[model samples]
Target: MNWLVWALLLCSSAMAQEHRDPTLDHHWDLWKKTYGKQYKEKNEEVARRLIWEKNLKTVTLHNLEHSMGMHSYELGMNHLGDMTSEEVISLMSSLRVPSQWPRNVTYKSDPNQKLPDSMDWREKGCVTEVKYQGACGSCWAFSAVGALEAQVKLKTGKLVSLSAQNLVDCSTAKYGNKGCNGGFMTEAFQYIIDNNGIDSEASYPYKAMDGKCQYDVKNRAATCSRYIELPFGSEEALKEAVANKGPVSVGIDASHSSFFLYKTGVYYDPSCTQKVNHGVLVVGYGNLDGKDYWLVKNSWGLHFGDQGYIRKIGRELSLNLGKQSFIPLILLVRSQCQKEESLVNRRSVYKTFFSCMFAEFFTTFKLKVAILLF
Candidate 1:
């Protein structure tokens, strides 16, 4: 190689480094603002020791968001800027107790059933506002309560916000739940059934931590008899279930760094897995520019994902995650007397038996005499 060519290449490399220094400083400032003092301090150490290649990849992908017009999703540095993929998984992913899933339970419905092209429970005034799970791993509780809230709105003509705190506190190890550490949606449902009902978010409130079960009987607002698990590996069944049965609680692999820093557009992580780690709610499904996507409601606050929602592509199973999704259906009980709908045989009358009192009046001579005597 000529001396002139070598000099030019070295000069270009120097200029590239100079350009990236400002961008790195900008990210450092964002990191300090997003996290608290403790987090900031820990991340400062992590950031300085971060791999150069990873930072470069992040900057490259973010640059491609604007440089490439055909890209479906946008990525940038967010709360997960400093953490590695392993750290993200340890902190965020929390779904557990898959081995305890009930056996002999048959999904009576067909997966091939036709479903509507688009459906959103929020439009029908069933879904509650987006919620944040905070620093705790209480996503299972949030997902459970979200499904219950939707069912309550459907059962009675009232949209009530159920409490995730109730599940976090009450559904302890006794019910096969590990509180904020990790839990299953079905276990939460069973806890609700065993403990009469769950309280409203207004009365109970979310503390985002594990605590003693301080549930008050008077505060009970809604109850569920049982919950069902959708047919494993059947996206069709999941779609149909969400369309007909309000929102369904689902588990996904939210361990990717890109998933953590997701800002907008349809998110499709090729590295996502079907191991079922994070719990979220599936509210609806729709298509965009020939690409079908599931409208997923996340518990990471309004700032995360697409306003706490993500559009998972319909089918582009390149990596191991594939298109297989895990979904569990929770059924709400109208009242106690209403025998828990016959889920076993799939044939039972689910009627609301209401007790009423009435007063009668009569002008007849005999009736008037009896009234006067009484």
Candidate 2:
């Protein structure tokens, strides 16, 4: 409380504040450089303000444990920073069908099967690139395509990125794929097999919108012999299938705020419902620092989550598996399909698994500013 001590404290605080500003400035500059093209259509000043406010809120949230409990993860500003929960749901939570196995269809179940303590398809070089679905509720199409792409690589030693646009356009009538509005991955696979295959992503590039059926027989890249549904609520069986077969297309309740802001660590939102609202590909499972997690590949782009991926807590989503397997992708392709495009050239969109070294960088920067100014 002495005068000299108080003055010294104030000066020290000012120095600290000056120290923190540069770090935040660096982060803001980095974000602008990375995402400037995406926001170029908007007013640059307005966009910067919005981004700055969101980043501040993210820092506050990151430093405090929410009412839900101490989060096993951290969240920071991302492409979805400005959206509300309802907006996030409308754009992201698109899957509608209950993932229950059909009572009429005889399905295989090995609910008690043993699984590896950890698995990563990326390690095996079977996973494809992380893709962005934009504002389209086409997560089902992407999930199905991801599984099939991995299967293609596993079976034929060729990794071909299949087209989600094919399902969006063509699978509406008979297969009941609702294009961007919503659809089931099972129905998408059924449509692909029924149509004799789907075209490559390059041949039928994603527009992220519903359009008229543009099925090109000449450009068919891969086909499925059959799609199999894994048992509902069987985490062990799902793990076995994923470890032995390849990636499995699974569903998760993707409408949580925690999910929207997730940056790293094993995400477990106790409020997340068991209802399958959005579809994503489960590429593997593992434990980190005593926490079990399902490594999911999402279609929200590299700027979202852990670079377009999420490590959701295994127990919260243990029973949400559906349409877990895809047959060989090359089993039904024609000779013309093989020769028209080189699969190697088409694999340019490949993504390495994202590292979480940068999660603390933004939050720590913002927290320093808060401590200094106060």
Candidate 3:
């Protein structure tokens, strides 16, 4: 598949329904039985099994290095172990449409205002329970709604579960949000603003697919006045945004293999690039074992990376601001195929649904990034 072009075997994540030491010969049978994985041909199964074994080796080696403290996180096996990188990328990829940048919205960081050194909206009783986006690439709606949910709670003292599916279905027409294919949080936000308000999840519910619009304004549960775009390539700006403001919507290049089986510890990867593809929420920031980290929430389900939460190396994330829509402001802007990427076939493949290589890259550039996508 193309990634739009690379063909390296990669993985996304789903909680493993069946578990057996990969060293066992019956592990494949157990895995197939658990996830109900099926293939049309015996040869196809052989090819996929080879990828699975390779993924096992990748996780083993990474965890071994982690034991020695060479890395911050450990890799694990999941239901997605049998899939290739291309297939995973297509499923997890998110799209963002850059805003026209309303002249009124400005990211003015008040140097005079004293801000908390750390913040976690979850601890403040603002963020709702972690949600699963299932198989749909509807992360844009989740990211936007997650942030809006926090803002609503912080303002009203009632944590309401907003409807992402509302945006997935109704935010399309004039807003250009592509429902399941993908969308931008800014566009999602705009849809909410224009429609007066969005409905609660209890009212609209989420089916994880493109459905007809049934957005009832009477059931409107939350709304945002406007969305702010942080100054690009600055970690400080991101820190302030999360600390001062409520949970903030952000984006990241979640295409690196390191993020696929990510289970715990501060996630960072040297192979990540400035290719933003997913949208997520940044609920807070703090230090962990001497490493500065950002508390991120994903829409991939409670099984993804530490109970649906992951810590990104906050200090060193490359937040590249391309000319695309949201990139200048830490949102997954357009990564329209830059002529197509070259296929990379490596023994230990490093492909992803969202990548971590930019953590190192961001260190030099001092940028901020985040991730999402179902």
Best by lDDT: 3
Q: How many residue pairs in model 2 have overlapping backbones?
A: 0
Q: Write the per-residue lDDT of candidate 2 for residues 206-259, one digit (tens) a residue.
A: 998889888898898787655655554566656766776678787777776677
* Model 3 agreement with the true structure over 96-170: per-residue lDDT tens digits: 645444433346565676877678888889788889886678878888888888766655567889999999999
Q: In order, what lDDT does every prediction score?
A: 0.66, 0.67, 0.68
Query: Which sections of candidate 3 miss by over 4 Å?
Result: 1-23, 29-47, 97-105, 317-374
In model 1, which runs have C-alpha deviations exceeding 4 angstroms?
A: 1-23, 34-70, 110-114, 315-326, 335-374
Model 1: per-residue lDDT, tens digit, 152-241?
A: 787666788888988989898787788777887777877888897899999999887888888997887887756766666667666777
Question: Could you tell which candidate, 1 or 3, scores higher by lDDT?
Answer: 3
Q: Estimate each model's TM-score.
A: 0.76, 0.72, 0.75
